[model samples]
Target: MAEDLVLDTAIRDWVLIPLSVVMVLIGVLRYFVSKLMRSSQSPDAKIIKEGQVIIRARNLRAGANFIPPKSFRARRAYFSNEENGLLFVPKGQAQNAQAQMFSDPNMAMDMMKKNLSMIIPQTLTFAWVNFFFSGFVAAKIPFPLTQRFRSMLQNGIDLSTVDVSYVSSRSWYFLNLFGLRGLFSLILGEENATDDTQRMMQMSGFGFDPSKSLGAEKDGLDIVQHEWALPKFEQRAEAVLKKLVS
Candidate 1:
């Protein structure tokens, strides 16, 4: 077991304060650069059509019970047709365009620009922090951390005498990288790419799930179990009126 050691105040003044300032500066820089990168890419027609097709199918299914029987049948027939339907039509919507859209040179370039923006800024930030501030037992967390987190939270410092809780300067920079997301959002509007956390989450299989496949959208619409809801609404309204009179 390591003995309790008191951390110096100079570490906070020289190390902690400057590291925090750098993190904020880097986030602000990332925001403007991301805006420039996004401004160049226009919405692709194929991608838009794909989303429209799926949305229309979902809408028709959900609102089917609410709409009149005649109107519902007409809408269903239009979407269910193999030749002209949004879900079934040939090369007419986003599903058909997915291959082309993904393969398009424009899309490839936009993705590259996005990756570059995320990679370059973070790489530089970490590199700058490591080069300038390495091997200093700067600060410790208020909360207890596990032994597993020892290497991660105290990167450069290998002193067995210090507890795992006492983090090095290198770890402090990363701690800010993930921890200051809320502050960054307040500084750069919530929509702006301040930390790229949301983007990374989306890219890392969290945004779109291939397992929840929409390949069966057409089949679902064709075999939908819908009941008339208007007639039931009329009966309820009459019941309320009769009670009010009584």
Candidate 2:
């Protein structure tokens, strides 16, 4: 009996206890390491209300290129958020009316997803670029990466700006990876890839959903009919861009 008890105790402490402790330690390490890694890339930073500060500025390169040594592209004025003390842009639907016209639910969903596919990768590219060269800290970066990307949902006509919210840090990080690859397809003019991206933007939370509006309510934003023209939106966006830049 004594020998058996000793053996059992030995197994409990040496094997079970050690293993359990190691696993717990690993879990903790992973949690922190994940957060550290996430912070390095993009931490879903929050956005402050507009008109709450004096002014802020962000330097945006004309074209997207992550490689710094080769990045001779001219830097342009990336907008800034004074309230949040971060540089970012307010992304919103470029044309709500045009997106509403698709009577086919599948088609609308498909188109929204495609636009989201575009925005997501563009966002990821921006985040990855900021991670290395933006003079931001590795773990303690000051600017909000997620905040800016989330706002881009509005840039697509199918997507409502309100739906853009904080996703888990892990989700945000991986989303960027997938997004980058997807964006490459759009940039290269791959027809299938571009279509896939458009479809992605239209699919509910993954894209835009008229049933669920977000920022519009809070801002008392005017809602045009779902069947509005797309070109008009493009023109409006151009005008807005000019005003913002000027």
Q: Using lDDT as the measure, which candidate wins? A: 1
Each candidate: what lDDT? 0.75, 0.35
Put down candidate 2 lDDT per residue, 1-246, tens digits, no spaces: 011111235544443344334433433343343334322223112212322211111112212233232222211112222233123323454344235434446554444444554455446644643443232111212333454564332222232222334232223333444554444445444544434434444544344432123233222211211221243666889999999999
Query: Which residues of candidate 2, in runs, are more than 4 Å off?
Result: 1-7, 40-216, 219-246
Error of 2 at 2 (Å): 23
Q: For candidate 2, what's the RMSD?
A: 25.2
Q: Model 1, range 23-137, lDDT digits (tens) per residue?
A: 8888888888877877456766655675677788889898888988888888887877766665664443434444554565775676667778888989998888889889888
Q: Considering only N, C-alpha and C atoms within 3 Å, which residue pairs clash in candidate 1? A: 50-94
